[model samples]
Target: MLDWDDLRIFLAVARAESLSRAGRALKLDAATVGRRIARLEEEMSAKLFVKSPQGYALSEAGDRLLPHAEAAEQAFAGAQEELSGAAGQLTGQLRIGAPDGCANYLLPQVCARISDANPGLEVQIVALPRVFNLSKREADMAITVSRPTAGRLTVQKLTDYHLHLAAHREYLANSAPLTCKADLRGHRMIGYIPDMIFDKELDYFAETEAQVVGLASNSASVQTRMVQSGAGVGIVHDFAIPFAPGVVRVLADEVSLKRAFWLIRHADDRRSERLTRFAEALGQGLRDEVTRLERLAADTTLAGL
Candidate 1:
């Protein structure tokens, strides 16, 4: 029979694609991790991973073993939940991957509230510009701008948020008068690097005439800072506007964009009561927070007028 402990180590290495990384995650030394993997391979008489300069790539046998191992892992998690009784509090670490914009502006307060309610829970937010690979266990769950069309995943639409062309008050004051979209061409534009835009929804300027980006970054937080510094105008999330003082909507009526955040998870994880409870709390928290922030943004804009 395959040892569950060895299988656990194998899963870690497979997900991390490196013995050192797996060891760090499992709190085992790299040599020990390698020995365990070698032992598992010998017992099965199949090479599970191929070491390359890039890292460990799973061999065909490893790929074939993945689903079974994941299923066993889930089964163990379910067993633990059952044995622990109804604790009414989630424990262990839950990592969520999200785009930098949402990560910076929304998750802080939202996660704080969640953590406050569940003292046993540890929440981690992995902010990156690219899509997270749930299949590789990159994160426990992910927040995305668009629903994924392919994957063994389940998605829930969290909330619809607004974005608009915005600039610092000083920038607008010093620059030439802007009366219409046509005038945007004369102003310095701040936005994402065209090639670095990972999602179609993030291509905010593609449909607009502001083709030239004088200040560009892949991070929304960076772009927001650039705009807040009176560098240039850019499309900024309404929920984020209140956080950027002196930043106001430039052409709210003429230029507006709406996008939604989606919560995605491995389809099989729905069976876990712990994750279900956390997901419920996270969804509600995010929805409420977005609404509150957007209202604050609108009020801030109106008050400044």
Candidate 2:
């Protein structure tokens, strides 16, 4: 008989694209993951993955098994949560996929509170630079900068947040004055790599005339760190600015940008009232947090730092 644990391992390997990454996620060593995958393949008497220099790619057999495996995973998760409920406790895992910016700067506080409230619940944060596919069950919920146009998902505006052109105090003092948008050309700029920009909302340089980015990364947290290190001026979220010493908003009057976060979840999961309540609480907490962030952003004392 096939083992469910092996299927879980297969899912991890498929999602991660590499044995090393799958091992990290599963808390197993690479050799162990490899052995389990080999064992699974032997049991099925078929090739499940195409091992390549690039990484493991799912074979035809693996592709055929994926959806069913995902369904079984979902069913198992639902059963565990429901069974726990019979014992008067809610027990399940909630994976939230978010961009590095939000995941690093904001979700920590929110997730902490959720974990405190539900001691039996396990929370997994999938902080990735790319878009999350809700249809694939990549996340139980997702927080996206823009509302997705199409998906069988429940979407709501979490909150409207702000971003500003910012740089370290030392970088601004030494660089050419950014009295206007035109002055931006004289200084180095850091932002997301143009070709790797996964969403249109993250293209901070779209309206700017920056000839080239001095530093670029797919992760917004990396871009923020580079800017904080006095590398260059970059657009940063208001929530993140106060936490980084010596970082402050620049050209605030001229370059503030408004964006909203959309909360998304698979529509079918709405049947669980616990998740719906948790989502509601999380959304409200996010709104309150953004309000605090906006106040801090507008404060000149902190901005001077």
Candidate 3:
């Protein structure tokens, strides 16, 4: 019989696309991952990957086997969750994936409410730049700026908010008046590193024609910190810096950037009270934060937060 663990290794290698990377992700050594793959291939009489300088690419048979393997994996997991759920006391780990800065401020409050509601629930929160796959159950829940793509998931729009250029007090006083986008030429801009999709909604200064990016990072927290430290002016969402201690929103009335936040959860577990509780708690937090964020944007007094 082909081992289930062997199939799991094959799935991981295929998903990650590199033996070494899959090894690190699976917490297995390179030799072990290679050995498992070799053993599986020998048993099945096939080659699974074509290796090259660019890394491993799946062979034809490997490609065909992927969906089946993933489907089986999902079936097994759903069965487990459903069976455990039927027994009634809420149990099992619930993974929440969210971006750093917002998750740092928001998820804890929601989680505390969930944990209170279900004592047996174990919460694991991973702060990532985005959600990867809802179909595969990469995380049980996600807080994201994007709508969930999986049809089987329940998606709730949490809030609508906008982003504006923010600068240190020194930059506003010493720098050119940010009355219009054209005023941005030559001004150093702190921004998300190129390749961040979230930056697409925040191209506030790109049309200014004089745009200059002084520094970049993929993290919202990093961008907020740099802007607060006087490194450069950066585009930040109202929620992104609702409590920024030293920065001020620049040209809030002029920037045309706004977006909605969403909470995504798989529907297979939708009827579970804990899932519903967690989602409701999170939605309430987001609703409350949206009001606070708008008030922050309106409060021109000191960026005191």
Candidate 4:
């Protein structure tokens, strides 16, 4: 009925038979021990100890629970050992969640390496959307561009990414080039729904006619493919633009915006090797890969935007 911590405190009190002695043994104060024991007793609905002039003595309920207490102690100890082995050996599934773009372009190789390294460990990469649950354990680790604020969640800034309005090179052949951010208003735009919103920054292109709700699907990959196919000028990240025959950069007049990417894990769940190794390996590898790709994207801009 009680938590492991409460059970540990209760066992200490029952073994010592003195609140003060149990508190001393557990490195907690007598009041703390009393409260924990009270909570346990309330949960089990059994008076565990009776107060005497000397100190605490086991009640009938407490006396009867001694064997079960010892068994629980041994069982918990065994569980701890098994968890340690699981973490160290990583003989389980590693679930990594991220947005579609990162999950598609980056995580595949990283997951392959993780699976190859830990043959016993299986890796499932889930591309969670803008609003997903990490606290509910939807996935073990996340590759995100937005900052998250969840209890027991730990985040690390993995890398920086830049977005630009781009289009097919052929599409831009006869049209006027977008010299400034506002020039995008005149272009036939292929837009993408905002994935990781830069809500805090005054990103120039966030909510203009450039990103007019009048346009296409919400998929980033769709935005990329459409732009590549000369469907319309779209806002695509530098890293996702494929070096196809036709793509070109549209509005190069002003710097759009660069966002910080994050690799996050639940602090409580980091004890597992599946999460630990995957986060570390995937984060560092993706950062390195993105850095290299960003440099390449700078060299060959997207077609139109």
What's the TM-score of every candidate structure? 0.93, 0.75, 0.67, 0.64
RMSD per model, one decimal: 2.1, 4.7, 5.2, 12.7
lDDT tens digits, residue span 245-282, model 2: 88888777777789999989877666666577668878
* Number of clashes found in candidate 1: 0
Query: Candidate 3 on 152-180: residue-level lDDT in tens?
Result: 77888877766777777876777766666
If ranked by lDDT, best first, what sequence of candidates would result? 1, 2, 3, 4
Q: Compared with the true structure, what per-residue lDDT tens digits does model 4 show for residues 139-202?
A: 6677776787766678888888777777787767667666666666667776544454423431
Cα lDDT of all candidates, in order?
A: 0.88, 0.83, 0.72, 0.68
For candidate 3, the lDDT comes to 0.72
Clashing pairs in 3: 185-210, 243-305
- What residue pairs clash in candidate 4, if any at all? 166-304, 166-305, 167-303, 167-304, 168-304, 247-303, 248-302, 248-303, 249-302
TM-score of 1: 0.93
Which residue ranges in model 4 land beyond 4 Å of their true spot? 1-90, 194-204, 207-214, 243-245, 302-305
Global CA lDDT of candidate 4, please? 0.68
Q: Write the per-residue lDDT of candidate 1 for residues 96-171, one digit (tens) a residue.
A: 9999999999999999999998786789999999999998899989999998999899899988999988888898
Models ranked on TM-score: 1, 2, 3, 4
